[model samples]
Target: MSKSYDAARDVFAGWEVDTEAALTALSQIPISMHCWQGDDVVGFEKKTGSSGGGIQATGNHPGRARTPEELRADLEFAYSKIPGKHRLNLHAFYMDTDESPDRDEIEYRHFIPWVDWAKEQGLGLDFNPTFFAHAKADDNLTLSHPDAGIRDFWIEHGKRSREIAARMGEALGSAAVNNIWVPDGYKDIPVDRMAARQRLEASLDTMCAEKHDKAHMLDAVESKLFGIGVEACTVGSHEFYLGYAIKRGTLLCLDMGHFHPTENIADKLSSVALSVDELLLHVSRPMRWDSDHVILQDDSILQMAQELVFTGLLDRTHIGLDFFDATISRTAAWVIGSRNMQKALLRALLLPQDRLKEVEENLDWTTRLMLTEEARDLPFAAVWEEFCERNEVPAGLGLIDDLDAYQASVAGRG
Candidate 1:
């Protein structure tokens, strides 16, 4: 379609720190595809390499284990299927195994393939806090573990991950990892509660250490909840938890869908960036009361824009597309996710940033969008009307990938 409000004007009005360069940088970001692997990773029957892990899916508890051939086959297939534009990485160290999990080839397992892929694709692999460390027979993996009094669990385990990461870096050509998603927190069955908190912090403290050898790209620290929470996560809405981690030099990974729908996410995010503890970022449109990790732009576009802009550190955000489905084929799942998130990013690019700033800072953002505004000056529909009228989308038949813009820019040899 024809252009609407100019992005340049909006950047100018907002007083962005490096307005020119930041706007220039926008064209380079691609929506990333993340997949969780292991026995559960390649569940499709049509696939040549996938194994069912001989674990029955029908049970109160889940089970998953991967045979070596099964694991190699899936990784190989993923490598071959990856397109030129989209980068690929291991989703999260392929955890979720039962206790007494096998650690054969422990040091070389995930890294060897990652190294091969990096050599092939010239890209990096994403990893997480739990990827390297084992909780051990003595240490508590869950916050609900009996030895809640232990403060050294993470201190010990994280150190191990660090050692493993150093080896992995040899394979990565000295690149900081593609991403790090930390799933550390509580589950609320509260027995030794304070002890549980200490253990959880211990886990995080290990991930927070500064490694000068490789620029540790801390993707995001996620704080989430359980259905009823037996080892209830202590990191929930507690300002001190993230603050403490930052003081030690780590970063918060914001899962966009984790917060309750009514929470003030954007403002809190501003604090997160202003605070010194963030690594990478995760963004998914949260379906109501559900962390489905669905496509973005499901929320009011204006608010999403506000949140994206408020961070002021979009340059640092890794922007992982965290979509999941238990049934679809992996390739199809990846493609569906690829389209869904690009649409959101495209929409953000289309939004008029200056107007979004006015609405975010001054108005009752949700209420104004939801049409609950009774105040005549801040009319409910007017802002949206102006917004829609002012915004512009690329006039096209299909979604555009982030790389398209870069390639087009390169074609002219500029």
Candidate 2:
């Protein structure tokens, strides 16, 4: 099999693509797997009414993980089927607790078990402050709420979440990316948009004023244009977060589904990278609006990987998956989305980037276009199969059978 990969390597070598270097690069890039996928975003937090805020996870899949043990089991299984080491993204609401603590009061103790488990699995952890799906967010506000008390509570939660993330990083010896995203916006026209934006800025400043060691945690802020309910405007627009990140020296999160339908977020990467120190990518598939659909091997994803590789920004970019499709197998969703991301990256790495750059730089537009089209017909499938073989996972459609067996094993349990 190594010789087989070597033979495929020869094909890549002809194009000045180092297959070994590409494989090594792909292996080093870590994709943060969202924890909500396993349980349909229904965290362990105690809540009375239906999920609030702008977020929603449709469908009622049968095999959804009902407990922490079950979710971790599903995550373990999903991670096993994918290549490369990865990180798990955890929302603060996904705490493993016997007694519920208010979001603001949550401490490092609630997530110690998760840190232990992640260490055992050789996986790093990323943290997010769950600004949605709570009574505090019933009015479609959190850090940006006009009410000072509500704003204060969420600010405390943000601080606590960051602390917990830092502790996890220190314990696991890998810096955890602590991300903040709030569903703060209006459904219709609002005369006081400035007030909300100002409140959000103040809250974020208060939360991020105290700095933690960068070796342990990196703080990032995410923005969205619109959502299911917030159709009119989103407080944390890309512009707002971009300015905030640059000024505050924080990482900016670029969620694939967070921009306008016609906008390609890949274009923003270079622009943002020029100012921001690092980036956190929430790789997702959006149907029309910000619908969190499972990712596929689509054009946008390919362009995203290419942009990252072409700009040579892979090391500074933190890749993470963000989607929940309750209509399909949760574990399979994890495997499919993560693997597709890896596939996109591998293809990007296998590209003759230097050759393409040379033609474009010299204004050889026709040759550049021809090369772009021709590169698609290269032996990408062969190289991908070799990656799967090297990773010891099922090659090609062989994963479907493995998924079927897993389904059978968990069929009767739920």
Candidate 3:
């Protein structure tokens, strides 16, 4: 260990916080890095379409991956810079195959390449059913569409996605979280909201009728507020999914940017943990809107990590990043976001939670507040640097030059 790390360790020891233990715990936790960032949500589909579901990757950044091979290479580079083992969160549309199959006709064979790649990289995989960027979703209504044919089409796609996810999980020996998020809502005030929700519920029932083993796959539902087109109402609101998750025994996905601007998802963690068996967090930074900016070590992320640690819900919560900033080096974006999340978790792990809870239980508000504020000034940087060294990744700005060299190499993609 470095001299700085040894000094920091002594400081933490005074507070009854074991620095070694914190680093070990942080290493065990894996952040599911989103693959959409590599290609700006433009999957390797032969018949490409618009990304119209309130999901837009702004900026014509150079060197965006044009093929699955390129994306995988970029992801490989990203994983190298980031500390600890991680998982890849893939969307259904990111299939790598020569066969042209519509969304509903997709099968596990189409994504065999991804599974093989993940095996080689020693990474787990997660999945999502893409419900946007197609002709059927042009109206921003999918499973809840008034037209029966359109709804059935989306329902079949969802079913196929689940099957694909199960295969991936079984192949990798980990439970792949198949999260479902749809852009089904209205732009203007609706005449009757009840019918749409009822239809959505019925469609979901049919889509999830075939149960897969929990060890191979887990179902999760993600809810969003109003989007670009659906400014009036989002069909799968948080309330709807929370209730559905509780009743159906599925994981509830809480996306940081999917809620109101003033709403803090950190506060909802403990409350929802009581009802849902597991949770899937889409950690993101929303700039004014659901801009999906790269996350930082901000208060929002810190409090979220603190909640998960304090409530003892870390085991049940799957951490996944959700952002696509095409404005910067895509690989650097992945590295920065993943490292920030790890830093937040490491900070949380080093907290004197037992003492804080003890003071709070005794109604000593002053000490509780003081200790919490004082904990912020701990020598977290030294400890973090040590962690990076141990993980064989660059610490601090050491990665900037490497990322710049990588950008130069890939600039020819234009």
Q: Over the stretch 1-414, how does candidate 2's per-residue lDDT look in tens digits?
A: 667676878888899999888888889999999999998888887653546566678897668888888889999999999988899999998999887798988999998889989989999999998888888898888899989999999999999999999999999999999999999888998899898999999999999888999999999999998876788888999999999999999999999998888899889899899998899999999997678899999999999999999998998999999999988888999999999999999999999999999999999999999989988877777777887888888866689998878867776665
The 10-residue segment with the lowest total lDDT in model 1:
53-62
**How close is every model to the real structure, measured as TM-score?**
0.60, 0.98, 0.99
Model 2, position 125: C-alpha lDDT score: 98
Worst 10 residues of 3 by lDDT: 45-54
Model 1, global lDDT: 0.42
Q: What lDDT would each prediction earn against the true structure? A: 0.42, 0.90, 0.93
Q: Stretches of candidate 2 above 4 Å error?
A: 2-4, 48-50
Best by TM-score: 3
Of candidates 3 and 2, the better by lDDT: 3
Score candidate 3 by TM-score against the native: 0.99
Model 1: residues with Cα > 4 Å off, grouped in runs:
1-26, 37-86, 89-105, 108-110, 131-157, 166-192, 206-220, 227-240, 277-279, 288-293, 300-302, 355-414
